[model samples]
Every structure is written in C-alpha cells, then in structure tokens.
Target chain A: MTAWQTKLTETFGDACKFETFRDNIRCDVRTERFLEVMKNLRAQGFDLLLDVTGIDYLHYPKAADRYGVVYSLVNTESGERAYIKVRLNDPDPAVPSVYSIWKGCDWMERETYDMFGIVFEGHPDLRRILMPEEFTSFPLRKDYPLRGRGERHNFPTVLRSDG
Target chain B: MPLAPAAQYPIDADETPDHEYLYTLNFGPQHPATHTTLRLILTLDGETIVKAVPDIGYLHSGFEKLGEDLDYNQYVTIVDRMNYISPICNEIAWHHSVEKLMGLELTPRCKYIRTIIAELARISDHLLCVGAAALDLGGITAFLYAFNMREKIYNIFERMAGQRFHPSYTRVGGLMFDVDDGWVSLIRTFIKDEFPKAHTDVARLLNRNKIFIDRTKGVGVLTKEEAINRSASGPVARASGVVRDVRKEEPYLAYKDLDFQVICGTGGDCASRYLVRMGEMNESAKIISQAVENIPSGPINIDVEDKLTVPDKSSTYRSIEGLIQHFELFMWNRRWKPPVNECYGATEAPNGELGFYLVSDGDGKAYRAKTRPPSFIHFSLFPHLIEGHAIGDVPAVLGSLNIIAAELDR
Candidate 1:
C-alpha cells in the first residue's frame, strides 16, 4: 500500500474499510468525516475531482441508516485514482461541501443534492438541478412514489396535449 | 441647474424596479439547441446574462426511483435512456459496475467486442457533437456534412442492434448478440475510408473559418485548474489540458491493451473543446480499426453457475435449460445479487466520464444506483461561462460544451 492509503487506514481504522481493485484504491469512510478525509486526500495529491454521486440503500438494514455518497478522485500527474464512499443516514444526511477545496465539486454536489437530497453544507448554490424547482420529492430516493402524483399537470395527457 | 444625470432620480419615482425591469428568458424545455427538454430561466441585463438558473426536471422520468423498484438486469435498459446520444457507454458502465461487485471476469472476446462497440458509440457521439456545434456556430453546410456521416454510423447501429438509438445491445455477462461478418465489414469500411474523409470535410468547412474561429476561439475559457476544479471530464477537461480520459486512466474493457492517445488542448475555450472532440473521433476510428483487424475468435459470453444467459426463442421448445435460463435472466428479481458492497465504474463516454455508482445490499435489486453524468456538470458551469458574453454567443458556448439535455436532466 502507498503512504496515503496507509495514513487513511491508520486514521479511520475500523471506520474506514480499504479495498484495492485494479489500479485504484477505494476507502469507505464514515459519512460524518467524509469532508475531512477528502481534504486530507486532496492534500496528499488527489487534486482532480473526477466524479461525485449518491447511492440509495433502502433494501438492507446495514445500509438503511443512510444514503451513500461516492467520490472518485484522481491525480492528473501521477495517474492515481481513489474511490471514497461516505455513508449518510436518513434523518440528517449532510456532509461539508468540498467545493471550497475543489471547484469541481460545485456541479457534482448540486447533482447529489438533486438526486438524493443529501445537502452539502456550504454549497454556494444548492438547488434542485435535474428536477424542477417545484418538484416536491427527491426522485432518486427509493421510497419516493414512482407514479401517479394525481395532479393534472403531472399527467402524461398534459404532455401529449403540449406535443 | 442643467439637467441632472439620470442617476439623480428620486427613490419613489414612477420607474420600473431593477428586478422587474430585468427580462426573464426561458431558453429550453422545447427550444431545439437544448439537445433535450432542459429549460433555463436566464435573467438578462441587456444582452449579457445576469443569472442563468437552469430549470431542469422537465424530462425527469423517475429513472433512479424506477431502478429501486426494478431488478438488476432490468435496470440496464434504464441506464441506456439516461444518455440517449451514446447509450452504449451507459450499458457498459452499468454492466461493469455489476460485474465488479459480482467479481465476474468478462471473457477476453467479450472485452474486445465491448471496446469496438464503445469506440463506435464514441464516434457516433462525436458526430452529433461536431454537427450540432457547427450548426450552432452558423455553419449549416458543415453541420449537414457531419450529420451525413452520422447517418451512416446510425445505419450501422441499426443493422447491428435493430435500433439506431438506445440499442441496449450490451448485457450483464456479454453482448445481447454477437457481431456478424456483415456488420464487421461495414464498421471496418467506415473506420478505414469514410470516417477520415468526414473529419477532413468538417475541418475544411468549419475548423479555420474566420467567423467560426472568432465566435469560438476565446469564448467560454475554462482554465485547466478551473476545469478540473469543476469536475469537467471527457473532452471538456481534455480541452483544458487536464488529460483525464477515464479509458487511459482506469483502463476498463481492453482500453489498456489498445494503443491510443488522450487528446488534449491548451485552450479551454469553445474552439479548443471543439477541436479536441474532433481529434478524439479520429482516435476512436483508429481504435475501431485495431479491434476489427485483431479481434479474437472465441465465445462472446462466459457460462456462469447460475443461468445468466438470455436464451434464444428457437431453443425454448427443445431445451428445458434454455427455457429456465431465459425465465431466470429476464424475470423480475431473478438477476444475480452482487455481494453487499459498493462499486463505482466510469467509462470514456462521448460527453465525458459517465460513471455509475452502485450499492448492493446483497439483494437482487440495487440498493442505490447513482449516475454521474458529465452533461449535468458541464451545463452547471454555464452560468459562469456565459456571464459577460452576448446572447448571440450562448449558442456557440452551449454547442462547445456539447451539453446533452437527456443526460443533464436525467
């Protein structure tokens, strides 16, 4: 293992599970400390923010605590890629925004906010991105209703009429 | 006193308030340049954009919510709909994520086939990007030329998968169907003869034209640091000198075996981004040629312990195993459950690094499937990119970003 991986494992210990697949190192960090770990990783040269996304786990009790926020980071020069998984529980799922550290997080954070409703604390403009402003629910959430909002405007008939 | 400057007006004068006077322009939801039904409410100051707030969700079909209710195998088709321009990458990324969690090793032949098809999709995506960009730049002639080539690529796709768009040809274990000899030759011919000429023609028509250059050269200048900071991927970042091609960096699906360059440009402006995508298309054509010429002879799919293969209709009557396999593979909740873990897989999508983050709670259905679409992120930077530019430059900047609204609004 490289120095950064070793440092991550030592710092988080049981809270952080480490897996090396292909050429990438994946660290599962506690959601509360996700921002801190990312900051540390950034300091250690994972400068590029490749992607940020949310994963729902309503199916299992183990993951039922909260949604998962996965951040993929890479160092442009070294070509080192790392996947950090942060678990956020349902009631107050919030993580500090890395937008301050990496500007790239601006959009990715908005997307996470849009899909899972996991608010990134300190995001400059946190708004519903993919969905409309009046959209009442987070569409990506497992428990969200898939069909029939009962509003006339929500009906496919309205769309057909417009077409 | 001589007529005081207009600024000396009383606070309660009968004049419109600054906020009310500002024009609220809706750019999309039905507008053609949006690429999809993405709606943006741009508050404009004269012709300059004051604030461009994107009002998306017009095309939100509850794909993620639907994924939760559907089984694993059934979700691949939904992924295809996320980025309609290049559905192959979506299928490949989802399949790869599932395969990773399941610890399934794809056959070498399957991997090669994936590379070929993915490159084809990349070429097709670049065709749309180039054609659409040209159209937005007011080069209707070049746009038509690029679309003409795009039509040929679409015809190839139709012949192979029986659908021009949303083929969903890639399956969990392997391809839904193998490439026949006819399809192989057609693709080979496209890569060798037709593809290069299209690139050349497009370049001749639009690349160095004074008007095209003037409109795009310095517009939407995102620096390398800014591009990376904004999580820009694919050509957007590459055009900014980020050199962050997921294929070259991560080496998923035989990209490691193939020799190709990660096309990069110094200028992070519209012109540089356009050129980078054009260069990438050339590279994609080269990759297709390599794959076609050196493709190995073997079964496209692996035989797993469970009946994971989709059975043919002809064998359903004669073979019980075929019938059972077909039922198991296609039936709801019968898809394989990957171990309880999370995996993130990214592909060098035409737009950018299209990623799929899947969380499996040891269930037949995905616990959570989040898509990291490049278009969404790229479009988010629009407010910053178009701030000082004129309304006329909006189309040029948007075209350069190649923001596919299907991916953005997904």
Candidate 2:
C-alpha cells in the first residue's frame, strides 16, 4: 500500500476500499464520507485536482452502486495520481462539494451536475454548464438514449438575415 | 511576476469607492478576441477587469455520449475532433487509455513510431498556438512564417495516414499504418531544416519586439502556487514555474527512452507562455529526430497471429488466414476482449495533459468515457488568471491557454 492508502484504510476501516489498476491508486469510498476522505487526501498531498466526473452504473455487470462520482487527483510534488470514487444512489444523487479543498472542481462539479444530474451540495454555482438553461434531461445517463430525446430540435432557429 | 496577485482574486480585497460603478461587458460569441465560440462576461471597472465569467459550450457536441455508441476503434474519428489543433494528440490519448484498459504491451517499434508522431503533433499544435497568438496581436509576418512549417507537418501526416485534417491514424494496439523511409525523411527534413528556419523567423519577429512585449509581458500572470492549486498544466502552468510535465512525471510511449527537458518559465505571463512553447518546440524536434533515427524496424501493428489488430491489405488479399482474421475482427463480430475494469490514461498533449477515464464492461464500447481535456481545465483557470488584468489582455490570456472550443465543451 502507498503511504496515503495505509493511512486511510487504518483510520476509516471498511469505508475505504483500495484497488490498483495500472499505476493509478484507486480508492472507492462510501458517499457519506466522500467529503471527509477528500479532505484527508488534500492534506495527504494529492493537491492537483485533475478531473471530476460522474458515472452511471445502471446496467453494469459488477457494480452495486447506481451512480459514482470520480475524482482524479494528482500529487504535483511526487508525480503520483490517485483516483477516488464515491458511490451514490439513483434518485437525485447529491454529495458534499470539494470546492473548499480544490478550487478547480468548480466547473468539473457543475459539469457532473449538468451531464449526470448528480448534485454537488454547497457548490457555489451548480447550474447546467454544457446544456442550455431550459434543457431538462441529463444526457450522459445510461437510460438517456444516444440520439437524445428530441431536445436538439427544441431550439428556435435563427437566420443570418436577422443580423 | 510583478503583477502576480497574492491571492486567487483581489477584487474584493481592494474594494475601492468606484467598485459600485463596475459595468458588465459581454465579450464575445462574435468578438475578434474570442476566436469563434468562447464568450466571457467581463465585469469591468472602466478598462480593468474586476471579474471575468467565461461562458463556454458554444460547441458542445456530446462527445462522451457518442463514445458509448461507437466501438473503441470507431471512436478515434470523434476523439480527433476534440482538440482540433492537435487532433492526433486526442487520437493517441484515447487509444492510450484503451490500450491501458486492455493491459496490452505494445511492441517497441510501435512505441517508437507513436512517440515520433506524438512529438510531431506537439510541434504542430505549439506552432499554431504561437502563430495564432501573434496573429491575435497583429504580427502577420510571424503567423505566415509559422503556418509555412505547419503546412509541411500536414503534408507529412497526409503522406503517413492519407488524410491531412483529421488523421484517425491510431488504433487500440497500434497505428493505422507503418512509417516508411520516405515518411521518416519528411520528418527528418522537417526538424533539421524546415522547422528551424520558421521557428527562427517567428522568434526574431516576436521575441524582442516592443509591441509584443508591452501587450503580453506582465499581462494575465498566474502564480506558481495558484496554478498548482487550480490544477493547471502544460505551458500555462509551466510558465508559472510549476515545472510539472506529464511526459517527465509519468513516462509513456517511449518518452522514458528519449532525452528531452521539461521547459519552464518564472514569469507566468502570456509572453512567458510563448517562450515556454518555443522552448518545447525545440525539445519536440529533438525527440522526433532521435526517435526517427532509432525507430525499430518491425511491425507497426500487433502481430496478426495474436488476432488483436487487423491484418495488412496485401496479406488480407492473398493469404487465406488473413481473410478469416479480418472477418473475425471487423466484418463479423468484434475481436476485443477487454477486462471489466476502469482505467485512466493520460498523455502530455501539446496544450496540456489530455487524459481519458474509461470504464469497461467486457463490451466493444465503453460503459463510460470521460475526457479530462486540457482546454477544459485551463479554461476553468481562465477567470482566475484574467481577474486583475485589463480587458485588452483577454485575447492574450485566452490565446495563450489555447482553448480549443470542441475540446473545452466536449
């Protein structure tokens, strides 16, 4: 185990499940302790928040959780990467925001909220970032069809002559 | 570094009496500074920018959603569209992720070829960014000089992959085709002669020019601590003296064998970014030259006996076994046997660290594919950089960040 992994597993016990794939040290944490775990990670030197994304595991073969929020963090000093994921259930999934730790998660959290309908509670601005304000459905969900649900056709067309 | 703010933003700390008079200026869906798509809501105190709200997603095409529908090989075409300036970077990064998920060890020859092409893509991307930044600041001669070499790069890629614009030349385990002696000479000719002349011309035109210096020297400064805290990478973060390059940090695709230095600058301004990119281009040329000379003479794709990749055209036409292998791989059922696991692989793309987070379910397509595009993260870092700068410095900062719209919103 890496230094942080040993520290976390000892303290949190069953809450932090460690898995290594390739070189990334992945730790899957339960949703409730996600924020606390992230805070600890921040203190442990995983300072660079490389990415924040969401995944819907509705029809997956091995998954027990319905939704997952992934945090791809990097320790700039050590050149190490850590992938921390938290399991959240289906209906209006919400997790505590990590904006307090890494200021970079502002857009990433908004994007997760935009694409998967997962909410980051206490996010300064949690509005839709990619899709239009009036657009309702979350597009990245597994149940959401590939061609979309006619939302593409709903926009009012404008001609160049109007200029 | 004189203008580097002590905090992330000092807009509230220096609350002057005229803070109430700050006016909002909508800076583009049409502004010349914002390329074609990026829009920023600049809350300006006369000319000084108090706060800049970058409005992206003007070119969102639901690429991650599209990744679900297309198979691993088929998604390269779409992936290339993300960072159009360095489309090959996207191709390599996507396939790198796929290769990692499958736990496939590429041949040494394939690794050398990928490194060469990847370095070429880096040069091409940096050239465009530098040239376009000059153009944005009205140095037409330097833009022409940079584009001249970029055309040579396009010709070389065209010769390599038979496509100029979006060469989807990368497969999961290998490249679309092998680089012949002629293609090798084209690159050798490029780095040794063509690239240097153009680079020198651009450097001479912009390096010590007073106008260029005045516009970019101290504008849009990102301090080292702020850059690291905000997860900035590539030339942007390196310019702030962060000294983190993914190629050096985590070596992949033959970078471990290559000799190249991570270029950095302490200024963290637009001018510093331009200089860092210039230094990186020279390093990229060094990488390509070395790899071209040492490219192992072997198969570019995985061995046909492994049934991991498609057979070559001549073999497929003549050999009966090749026909069956082709049919088994593409025509009938797909031959991908991936583990049901998740993997995140990243490349030191020219713009920054372009990474792909892939989750596999033993299916031909990915269950979820999330892209950590450099443009996305860097654009998020935009408001932080542009907070205390003037309205005129928007293009300088934005162009230095090199925010490819498709990549930003993907």
Q: Which one is best on TM-score? A: 2
- Model 2 ranges with Cα > 4 A deviation: A155-163, B1-20, B331-333
Native contacts recovered, each model: 0.69, 0.77
After superposition, candidate 1 runs with Cα above 4 Å error: A9-24, A151-163, B1-24, B304-306, B314-316
Task: Please state what fraction of the native interface contacts candidate 2 reproduces.
Answer: 0.77
Cα miss at B199, model 2 (Å)?
A: 0.7
Can you write out model 1's per-residue Cα lDDT over B346-373, one digit (the tens) per residue?
7778898777777677777877777778
> How far out, in Å, is residue B253 in model 2?
1.1
**Model 2 chain B weakest lDDT span, ten residues long:** B8-17
Docking class of 1: medium
Question: lDDT per residue, candidate 2, B331-350, as tens digits?
Answer: 52465778888989999999
Candidate 2: what lDDT?
Answer: 0.88
Best by lDDT: 2
TM-score per candidate, chains pooled: 0.90, 0.95
